[model samples]
Target: MQDMSASLEQSKPADSPRDGHLKRTLENRHIQLISIGGAIGTGLFMGSGKVIALSGTSILLVYAILGFFVFFVMRAMGELLLSDLRFKSFADIVAHYLGPRAGFVLSWSYWLSWSVAVVGDVVVVAGFFQYWYADVPAWIPAFLTLFVLLGLNMLAVRIFGEVEFWFGIIKIVAIVLLIITAAVMIATAYVSPNGVVASLANVVAPGAVLPHGISGFFAGFQIAVFSFAGTELIGTTAAEAKNPHRSLPKAINTIPLRILLFYILALVCIISVVSWAEVPANRSPFVELFLLAGFPAAAGMLNFVVLTSAASSANSGVYSGCRMLFGLAERRNAPAIFARLSALSVPVYSLLFSGVCMLTGLTLLFIIPEVMTVFTLISTISAILVIFTWSMILAAYLAYRKRNPAAHQASTFKLPGGVPMAVTSLVFLGFVLVLLALEPDTRMALCVMPLWFVFLLLAYRRRTA
Candidate 1:
């Protein structure tokens, strides 16, 4: 009877195959938009001001350098996924090469990373609402976003894909328009109320290139690494991608170009329009620069875009967290409940779990109104956890290469400098962790980060033993 019961449970279908977790509903266009959308987060829209203040003109170089390194990391990841169609994302690949123990760590850590990130994005959404109405509490928007996303995710993965597609489209259009506006102002040599004009001096001028010198440049590197945090989400969704082998490569190739045009060019335009020293760390210089340049309408429009960008991050946060949880359950690392799916083929349990966690943002706003610090702390911790996952991928790649030299020799999507580039990328990430500790405020992340791992280790020991 016990054996029969076990057989029945094993055969039970939690979700209909048709309605189940995204089965290639994401086409090439959907994949590209999602990749672009994930890459362009609230960080670029909101956090760029602080990064600019920290590194001055050198921040651009920091992004460029970091972008260069992460590109190789993505290439290595892409090569692994293409090597085996069964490999969904980093977690699956880690599990395959390392062990179930490592996979659990990667999966849970990744889920927590995205879950924590939702807090930051949710808080930002609340703040954006405050700009329109002073009395409205932050929790309202946070809670509303949480419920809205919950409903959307529970329906179908395709719905979530479509929403993110448009959310990302809004961001792309806004940035393109901002670039055009900056270009026109530069060509005309128009002076802003701040008495700055577009010129090459913005990048090369003294106190601009290295405002805080090497220290500031390093500081910017840490911040820029955090900004590039979600670029790997493309890999996460690869299993669900309709044609991952083709779509994955296309998405990965776009990263460096995106960084060059969106990140590098955008910053150059902003700094040229306003001095690096004058760019406020607390305020979004993008919006302020538009206002200063006698384009109040564009400023207001950009504010709307920033608001949408925050929402976009929160939306993707739920999508990513739920999927990560589903992946974990498939590997037996998470509760069976997380593996359960609705008639629509969605992992409803994991979806609701993330939604409820995001709703905590509302509780936070009421309990601790000065929640930006909490947001920053969570964001830093999430970034640290992601570095762990990335390292695991490189480690897996090293092992995979050792095991299959012939396959590596035949692969087309190979890293340029081979294993050395992978090792150097790992080392650079470690260096960023040290830099995070150097900052008094960010040091809190180091303190909280270990507690998470300790908890994971305990769980792993209990499960294994």
Candidate 2:
């Protein structure tokens, strides 16, 4: 590992081109909010309804189980990143411990994952816009959003951080308000128009937990996996994060708690207010909860919240895609143009390339007029790619320990259970893959994912040649 790391270090020129390095302008608060934004994905807002409809009360267990494994994934990522500040991203760590080929594939895979996910997010945002302006063209909002985010991202890294910070704040406030309102309704025994009484009993009713049986319980993993797609995004921010040793660990350590509060507790509140059986699979449960509470304008208000949530997710996606492209360029895995930073230290060409890729969202919207269908398809592909990305992180971690025993021993933020936990996480991810095969929608994506790897293999070989 040491020799490989040294060779990798030696490969890059000691002197970089002017403004080649990314700026470390992202502060502790920015990292905190970005972490929150990554944790509370747009899937929780848009996809949770379907998860509840499928898994019933068992959705809680679904989030809990996925959250447990995801937390460990983040921890493993945190340790690997902090072990060396020279590691700008997990791809860098993978290249050092796994090999340049693994790094190349992982970087491009992660870039594709975010790129695909952003397409879904932009599609959803357009749908949210249509909720208010029923006659407006869907492509309008989608295009405007991409253009604005691209402009913000082009200015500087801090602007991107600020945008995500406020976006994260909006999502947090929305979830908290929903939880509180639900608690008040449950305490008052408010009865909905459907004659269902708001009570904690609704969440714990007999047969409620597995209303659709174990198949439904297992079925929840597909979108639930997509919901956790960006949980490891903070790993990509290592290059631009200020005080990474302090901020990265702090941000990652809170992931489990964030999942508990934002996902598990929030779902419990929603389920208690509206029976899991009544949760609309096609609509957001957040908006449903407010509408049940007699808020006539709940749809529009929650629509705005979810719109921003989706925008936040897309924004993060663009930023991550740009960084991954930039990283790939630095390693000579991609065109050198993407490695050139702007005067403000942002990767200008990389940002432009990502924005262009996201334009495919508009084309998808036109082809697939149904928003949910497009979202489900895109999200499944994103989830498959995410699973591959996380698996590589664990695989890289295991190799890091085997090759750098001394570094592992000296690390302050070591992944608990070490090799065993890493193995267990890998097994859990594999099980999720099997679950993906059970549903026709996700199964198609699972089957198609190999083509991406085949393409990557060809690209890697060509790069090596």
Candidate 3:
């Protein structure tokens, strides 16, 4: 491990084009926490209610199943990053093992997904402000916050890391406190304002783990998969980390712990506090669960935490998007200007570009009073695109394994089940795409994806031309 770390540190040239723009104050611990922070967004705080409404108590099963695939997907990514330290990010891997065309698609597809996701998060931030001031327009907070986030990104990557560190800390503390509260309630058989006691039966009653039937059960997986979309941001940070070899694995290894704490334990606690029947779809189920537990203050507190989560996510999008632009420019994949860095060691062009994309939140305000509807579609599409990116990671892993089976054997963080596990994860992602196509609301994302690919192809062709 020490040798690997040293190798990673020395592998890239001091003035290498790939390393030219990335800020290097990000350390191992920051990378680890940011990975968790990036993955655990405000969605769990706000959107889990929809899954409960669709599948009832059986939502837990969906989380477990989807999380299963997501973990191995991360493992595949870890393997690929370790395969060659010169692979600055996923785009590099896609271009190398696959073809430049595949790399181009993966790069822009992820860029679009995260870019749109930033817009969705901006809308959520707008709503977060309205909780305190009813008359304030959502777009005001959304666009204003985007400006603030852009400034932070431009200041330095370490500033972004510091921000995400605190952001992750808040959500982690909230989940810990929530779990403790739920445990106490379960012990006392605490009854809610809605007249339900905290107990195990809540997760098994009525729906009995498949209440939505097999279809609803699968739909819940779609929701769970979306929740896990940004979990792999650690991989992207590898190039910027002071110790990518150690930090990257340490960050990726937290998958099981995060899934257990955030997804499994949190879901169990929510359902245990309030029956699945009481979980609301239109409103945040997290807020409803706390309110049912008779803590009006809890609703406001969770609201604050989720608001931070959204900010953290949009903040992360801005940072990664900038780094991606830097990578693209180094390879001449994006415009030359985007590859430039500031004296502060920040990717200013990427930050400004991402901020501009996020400013589209104003359009949402103009078109829809209830932006959540559109936000959900866009986020789900983001999740679907993430699946494609994860699939590419697995494909890259397969290629790496075939080329250097010994490297796979020698790695410290090998996927436990090897190729079969990677294959299973890929198949599950494909199934998720199928699920996206089947649902009328999500089907729009499926159609949008092909169009997105075509646009990326044209962009790549134009770039090469």
Candidate 4:
């Protein structure tokens, strides 16, 4: 461990190129919105219907439980990142304390996580575009969106931040409007086209919350967990964030509130307005809330919001994947070309590589007749990989606490509950993994995820050799 630490220390000075470093151009507002963007994903907009269908009003409990643990995971991550400003990414912290091989595997695994997620986002966005123009080929919108996002990302880091900021705003406004509209409808006792009245009683009636029993409640975790996939994305922005000490903690601390407002509260409003039993299992409940409230154009507006939400997620994927590649190259885990920065301080090659890889999703659209099936499979795989990523962050935190007791003691932004909380969070994550197997859709991804780790192990050995 001492030798590994020593090597990591030695590599830092050599890795630092005054001109090549990623620019810390991300302001507090950018980090704040990025955090918001990460918390609200396409899964919430698109997949929550399935969660509601399976779990009924118990979906709230599912998100609450997951959000509680996820907050601690972020705290652990925030504490770790703030512990050492030199830690560019969680992979750096993992390599520093858990050894390089673990770091290498995690770096690549995280990249693949975002890669798979972006592909899924691309597929979803194409489907969204076709909602308005049914005759246009799916691949056209898929590739065009990627082309636009890639160009924006290639220009500069702040440009990417600006794009996400507005995307986050759109999502926030849409959810807020939905919540307010639902609240008004519930108060006014507005009735739907099917004669179902909007009322808070709809959400809290006897046995209504768990209509399908505990097993159905358990099934909700599969998709609800996927909705929180990008919550840890804040950790990846440490290298490029301006004044992370202030912005990161503020961002991390508000996670619970975000969950309460954007997830739990929003969901409650939805279930109240359109009883979970009546909510469409395959479509967005958000759009349903607006449409049922007499907004005829709500479909188009919500469709655009979801389209940008998916685009925002894919944009994040592109940004994170390239940055992870850059970090890996800096550590000599990947080809050095990825380490090279453009004049704008962007990792041009890495960005292009990730974008090109995402384009492969277009082919899946052509080959697969059922887009939702492809989305379900890809999203489940991404969720599995995300579990691996969050687990590593917790593990790295434990290692950091053990290896550097003084650092933990001195941290200005410490994770609440420290070591015990980290362990509990890990257990909760494991439980979620167990839940994934309760359904065949997620079970297939769970069974297949091990192959990724095995391949990573082989690659690690060959790289070391």
lDDT of 3 by residue, 233-337 (tens): 887888788988888878877788888898789888888887788877766666666677788898789878878888898888878777776666666677666
Q: TM-scores, in order shown? A: 0.93, 0.97, 0.93, 0.96
Ranking by lDDT: 2, 4, 1, 3
Model 1 error, position 429 (Å): 0.9
What's the lDDT for residue 22 in model 3? 62
lDDT (10s digit) by residue, model 2, range 1-465: 568568566435234574367778999999999999987877999999999998999999999999999999999999999888889989898888888899989999999999999988888888788888979877788888888878888988999999999999999998988888999999999998888899999998988899989999999999999998898889988989989999999999999899999999999999999899889998888888888788858657988999999999989999999999988888888887888888989889999998888886568878878888989999999999999999999999999999888888999999989999999999999999889998887899889899999999998998788
Q: Which candidate achieves the best lDDT against the true structure? A: 2
Where does model 3 exceed 4 Å of error? 1-19
**TM-score, ranked from best to worst:** 2, 4, 1, 3
Considering only N, C-alpha and C atoms within 3 Å, which residue pairs clash in candidate 4?
none
Each prediction's whole-model lDDT (CA) = 0.79, 0.89, 0.77, 0.87
Q: What is the clash tally of candidate 3?
A: 0
Consecutive 10-residue window with the lowest summed lDDT within model 4: 10-19
Q: Give one clash count per candidate, in the order shown.
A: 3, 0, 0, 0
RMSD to the native, candidate 1? 4.1
